[model samples]
Target: MTTKKTSIIKVALLSLLGLILIAGVYYAPLIQRLYFSLNIEDEASMPENLRTLHQYYSTHLIESSATPQPFPRQLQENVLPESFQSHGETIKTKAFFTDAKPTGLVIIKDGQIIYENYWRGLTESDTQFAFSVAKSITSVLVGMAIGDGLINDVNDSVTKYLPHFKGSAWDKATIANTLEMSSGVEFDEDYSRTDTDMRRFQMAYLFDKPMEDFLLSLKSNREPGISQGYNSMETQAAGFVIRSVIGERSLSNYMHEKLWQPLGAQDNAYWNVDGAGMEVAIGGLSMSLRDLAKIGQLYLQRGRWNGEQLIPESWVLESTTPSKPYQMPGRDNPLSEKPFGYGYLWWTPVDPNGREYYASGLYGQYLFVNEDKGIVIAMYNANNNFNSAPDWWKERYEDFFQAIAQKY
Candidate 1:
């Protein structure tokens, strides 16, 4: 009740308020990232979210080259077929595109842009998220490292480069096993489930937990190289090895030097980084559709660009080929998650000719290359209902791509 006590109480309250304001300012970025991660995707806000995701996450820029190699436009008339076979039924190709319009689609055949279209307000200049297609990008970086003699071989144990993984489940895993999705790491990749290991990994990224720590905590359910298992963590582990072998150089910097510049990328790319500034190698690359197609083009040329071997020819061949029986593509194949066979972070369709392979991501993002036909298709979609969509939807898209390739 005393005047002195009242003034003291007011001062104490003000001091606490000042501390709260300071804390809020200090942790504003983390709070914003958390807010973005926790909210459900509103269809109305999806476009802006895709465009501005870099603002919510830390990122490293992949600067474009001075001499950009833009694909020459030779737009085909009625390039897409009327229909394609899916489950022995003729599905209209136009209907497929109408039902789930992608943000952008770029079809390159014989080093020419034969077909290019945009929907959902996406432009050729606008960079879209690559999602888990980034795994294929990471694979190329690893191949480059091997070619440079920085990494001894694909068969080498991951721990050979990343000593931190020694004595962990990854100690026995080879770089090849990780690339083939055969690391046998016990990770529940079911996205529909909240309690799955994939969700735990996402939480770690959202909460600014070190990705390496989560990877280290994982244990193997089956022996390494036994069968194909889709594990994004395996790609992250390969990324870690890349960062380690390159010494003090950052992964994004190395990517720019080895990949972007060599591919003569027209636009600067963005690789999303975690709290500690480590690139999210499993997913999180964003670039223009043209530039993304350059990835396919590079591999299509067997890693040679501008008369230089950016990635070794042997590495390119090995990356696309399914060497193991368990990695073969089949609907009833017990070893793999999807019907597509696993390669070195690439998807091998069961083609008798051994011509085509692709880099795919969630929500319909794909970088497809038909080597024999000299076709490369780069598609970016905002298929929010992708998880719930019929399994044949993806297969249908594959058939359409094949039809285009055959026509070309």
Candidate 2:
């Protein structure tokens, strides 16, 4: 009787082991993300981690046109001012270089490069990480898709194109909702936390999971449009919708044909891709500072460059200006990524500087455009205080730009 019981136990254990193996294979990507969490905070390797991080990730090259666009040069010999006033203190030009940790700065006024500088082992040619600024790029593509009639309407439900989302809670969410970060999806944007939805996204990406599969696996934490949540996955969903609508066309290729080539980009760009081989449309673009400024110019020019209509003017205004219900969220009931008001993947500040918006990424990548002033400031940094810093740096950059604009 004892020998018979031992044999039965062995059989049960073997069956359980087989089941566990099957489950592991199915959940391998999630497991890998958990494994990758171990190195989330390890001190970055040399010259700056972004440069190396770019080397480690899966990437796709976005080619420039055969004839690159050239900005009319009126290079000012002395680009830096003696000092600029910030928060009641005088921050000298040295502070921007040493303290602010700027890697590149390109100032364009009246459609010409007035000042340009590169540092931190970076050059005008080096394709620095655009980070979240890539979201703005992705936003433009949505506009293009609309303009091209690939996407019928912004108000249409996301499930209209990506049928996979039909049974999901996002079925009712509009493309506009995702663009404005009002999707109400349960995705945490915090990169500092190992268990954050952002890290889970990275893990899924590393493990080669389809971006859509990862996005759809999420649950609806709140009713779509009932609240606003600033998460990368929202834009990821937007990109997925674009991919679904276009079908077989790569985002990078579409960008090359529509904007990169048309705008006459000076250099070829690279967009970070996922293991499933889709562009990381939320925040994975890397390009030279000059080309980034060109993107800014696309907006500043009211979507027209060199007299060619690249992005529609109406779309430009609609995207930057705050839309009601979805975009102009009430402060007392505030739920946003930042204190700043948002409009279609762009950040809008409460500054009394009148109406303005800019594209910002976690790594201090910024493309500031003062449309009224016809000024575009493209600044890139590898700041150590990313997401942990106070609002001072942003305010200081604004102060510097204001001072620079007045001088010019």
Candidate 3:
């Protein structure tokens, strides 16, 4: 071959290699997280839960071409709770140093707004991601379905609704078990770098395959219902049971009719849809923080709103009360692990003076309700340190709640 031809061939090969390198870097996990925070709509390869969540917020929560509903207001108050003011200062300091953003914070006491704040360029009008806070919402919907006779009972096997799971490990699991996170399924919830089971699950859900199929593919790590383990996939299984009970309706539509419209939500919200168009019920909901507070308010009033019983009063009480005794499942149970216990998609703090439970999520998302004091506090943060934040924030929130309780 001629020298000139050889030189040209070598240059062409090098150029191709460079292009491939650039693409890999752009698609790396860190780059993906950065890209998702900015251009969420275009990043379609995210976890099915996240992708659906983004689609929901973009399409329904915003006041844009797709959604035209005016924000609704059940009630509004101007007074700032003294407790919230003091706690806000502490949270602000912690958040600034930890590379996290607080999207919104709200406190409701005695049916009046005591405090409200927003950071990170989010306003009362902007909808923020719920992370796993959506799980609590799903839990509420399950209660509603039970009240309406759509769901027969919590003890009913999941196979009753989802027959595809009839022969699987889930067949022996009850709806109540799943809600309590005691389904005994061996699934990992870690989101660290590399190919974890969670990553595999995300890939499958995002790529448009059946979540049920993916779930059934999991092997049992423990005997069914022997212990409690926090597994996001179990929540997805709960969603499947809900879908089975209310066939032919979208999760968004069901939520709209049962909760949003009835509770008079200030804004429309969205649920991320899977490849089969099923809402990613595990943790794919997005809504304004103020509106999110309204959800907590509904529970505060025992599921009653505007002289109507939106959810069964009995169901609400049972759902919030801890079902299991306080104990750790694994050997390395962190001190942050609650000794108080867990309810239906809610976490109870180990406070002896006052009974407090909350809908909690990774990255500092919380909807804390203290029935003893008639207080409901909602907060959203973008912290990624799920393990550390829960323990640390619980203490901060308890202190905040105690100060507020003294006033009442």
Once fitted onto the true fold, the runs of candidate 1 whose alpha carbons sit more than 4 angstroms away are: 350-354, 389-391
* All-Cα superposition RMSD per candidate: 1.7, 6.3, 6.7
| lDDT for residue 341 in candidate 3, whole number 0-100 | 56
Per-residue lDDT tens digits for candidate 2, residues 307-377, read 88887788888888876644653344455445456788887654525556788876578888888778888
Error (Å) of candidate 2 at residue 297 is 1.0
Instruction: Give TM per candidate.
Output: 0.95, 0.84, 0.76
- Full candidate order by lDDT, most accurate first: 1, 2, 3
How would the candidate models be sorted by TM-score, starting from the highest? Answer: 1, 2, 3
- Candidate 3 RMSD to the correct structure: 6.7
Clashes of each: 0, 1, 2
lDDT of each: 0.85, 0.77, 0.68
Clashing pairs in 2: 69-264
Best by TM-score: 1
Candidate 2, residue 293: lDDT: 93
| TM-score, structure 3 vs. true | 0.76
lDDT of 1: 0.85
Per-residue alpha-carbon lDDT of model 1 for 1-408, expressed as tens digits? Answer: 699999999999999999999999988988998787665355656655666677788899989987798988888888878887767888787778766557889999889999999888788978887788999999999999999999999999998888878889897899999898788888888876799999988888887788988899999888988888778999999999899888787889998889888788999889998778889999988888999999899999999988999999999999888878878888898877778777899887644334898888777788999998899999987776676753455666677788888886
